[model samples]
Target: MSAHPENRAGLWVALASFVLWGLMPLYWHLLKVVPSLQIVAHRVIWSTLLVVAWLLWKQGRGWLRAALAQPRAAWMLALSGALIGFNWSLYIWAVNAGHVVESSLGYFINPLLNVVLGVAFLHERLRRAQWIAVALATAGVIWLTVQFGQPPWIAICLALSFALYGLLRKLVAIDAVGGLGVESVYLFLPALAVMVWGEAQGAGGFLPLGGAPGWGLGVDLLLVFGGALTALPLIGFAFAVRRVPLSVVGLLQYIAPTLQFLTGVFVFHEAFDRDRLIGFVFIWIGLAIFAIDGALRARRTGVTPVAAASEA
Candidate 1:
């Protein structure tokens, strides 16, 4: 079927979002000297300010007031805020700590994890192909765990946290940007506390602390600007999802992880031995099955697989 002109535009926007997400490892790597937790704290603070301001400008004060008045949505966003905050912190830490490949694996597996969550918690039925795909992914994880002599905890944490966050957001009534704004607001206080503590302890990077290197204006600007950087892709995602087919967006979601995987292997030169390749191959096969299943189902239903829109 041919896409509408607006949807074609949305396809580009969606691709842009994924590309930015894919290239994010390089951005985080630039601030490798900063502590991940501090980076996350700044992310929370700046994102809250930027999103809130955008909400004010685009939607006006009434939008924020109305959203804040919805107690259930507020509570839901609070939980989601925690999940996303944890996910961001871990992802940043993983990239900076030279675990970019594992982090990429986490995001690559996130969609499958979302499927598992849907079946387990939402009581959704899974087709045979989906079951096979899940099994393959599970085997891949097992292989990686055995190969490494431990589970891929970084990937698991990133996948589960993000999956749970998407699930909660699905249950909420707010629009994407508004929901994120609420989440940022919910997380603001704790993020502020962390930043304050970091400064007090001389560990903060954005702001010069007593014992730390004096802050360069460049570093401070980058730290504060992390807010806009965080919000932009999400804003693009919000725009694209509303305009295009979810299946299209789902296919595009892989772009980010692909970039991350390449960055880890080619750019960062992290270890990629034969055993790790075998494990990733299993995952690649599983993802192929999953994508085929989705395409078939989308064709049959004349609608995109609802589950495929789980990207967050």
Candidate 2:
């Protein structure tokens, strides 16, 4: 049977969003000269501006007030904001530091981590296949750890931070944009303070004021555009979720990390020896099992899986 027009459009939108997310390493790499913290601060400041402007336009001036009306949601969003800010900072730093391959692994592990979080916090039960998938992924981590003689801390931290952030967001009673808007507001002051301090120390990246040797206009533009880059994919994902099935979205989530992996190995020429490949292969098999199981269950039950909000 032919697909509906909206679904087709949604598929394209979803694909675009994930593609943008996947290619983000290249974008951040362009600003490798800038301090990772400065880049993250700019991301917060500009993302705040864009998100707040969009919210005001769509929901009117009372949007912030409405979002903050619930005290529970207010505090929850504050925590989630902190978590995401940390996630963004680490991710940008990792990309610039040439840990893109490891960073990709973190995202690859995130969905499985989500399943574990669901079981622990939400009292959700995993199917048998899910149990096996998680176990296989765990073994992969252990193998990687043994091979490297140390843990993949970058990947592990990213997965943990984002998983926790997703958990908090799931419990909050706000729309994705609204939640992000509030989170950005919560982060705005601290981010602005960082920017101000950096400039005062003559370490800023945007302008050469105070005799700071700023990178250049190109870098400045990329930093500013990072806000839109961060937000547009989220907006697209939100739109796509309403038009597409969750199972499809779940499967599509792999695109970003796969592209990131390829970018790291092929584009950046990062090291991916046989040991690393073996570890990744184990994780990939586990993910395949997880995806196939979910699809079969959805087909049998005739119930679409619940759509997850995009963390990218």
Candidate 3:
């Protein structure tokens, strides 16, 4: 298929999105003083502010008022909000708790899981090569489980939670900004309550506190900075989705995980056992074949490239 301009744009945006996500562990590393929970709260609050600000900037006050008009939309986004919160909190915990490598593995496996979810819930069938990709990814996961003598619980949990979150989001009739705004709003109250509790316990986060604050405060600021960073790439991704084909976008997602994998092993000093080595080999091969297949299909069918259309 010929690439659409929007598709090309979205591909770049999505590419940027993964790159940022992959690099996030480093930012988390700076939060040595703030409790991980506090960091998450900051992410919620700051991200909420950033997105709402964008909505106001883009559509004026009416967007917020209009969003409130649809109770169903509100509810759907609320559910999605919870799922994302779980996903985000768990992810932050994983990275900070010395499971950065495992977290990367989760994302590497995510797109494949997304494919499976599409089949199970959306009734979309995979091509034969795509099935092989699934098989290879499954084997890689199984390898990790056996290596650990347990399920790859941390990684699997993150992937499944996010997959389910995306599924729920798909069921809703909301735009990216609108949906995220609702979800964050829903999350904010509870988050604020937690901060209040933390305050009572002398654990108030993201505020000016009295003690010689630890390095975690720096991390809190980073979290806020990340919230600002997060919005731009999503906006870019929304643009890209409309212009690119699914196959192209799908192929590009690997860039994020690939970087995470490298960061885990090289930067975080994560161990790569023999089993993981073999598993990675399988994943790499599977991806190569998957790409070839997707490319061939695009060539033969001449499907139009999808544009980045604004879903986060």
Tens-digit per-residue lDDT, 181-243, candidate 1: 989988999999999889888887555754577467787888888888899999998887876
Q: List the candidate 3 regions with Cα displacement exceeding 4 Å.
A: 1-11, 68-71, 205-207, 210-217, 305-312
TM-score of each: 0.94, 0.96, 0.88
Q: Which lDDT value does model 2 have at 297?
A: 72
Taken over the whole model, the C-alpha lDDT of each candidate is 0.87, 0.89, 0.75
Q: Give one digit per residue, the lDDT tens place, for model 3 in 1-312.
A: 335554456666777876886787887767745677877777787788988888889889888668867756766777788988988889888887888877877887777788799999999999999999889988877877777789888889989988988887777756766777778779888877776666566675454543434335565567678677656656665656666776677677777778777888898898887887887777677777777887788667764543223332
In order of lDDT, best first, we have: 2, 1, 3
**For residues 1-312, what per-residue lDDT tens digits would candidate 2 score against the true structure?**
018887788889999999999999999999898899999999999989999999999999999999999759888999999999999999999999999999999999999999999999999999999999999999999999999999999999999999999899888777788889999999999999999889889888576655677888888888899999988998888878777776778888999999999999999999999999999998999999999998787677654323433322
Using TM-score as the measure, which candidate wins?
Answer: 2
Q: 126 in model 1: Cα distance from truth in Å?
A: 0.4
lDDT of 3 at 15: 78
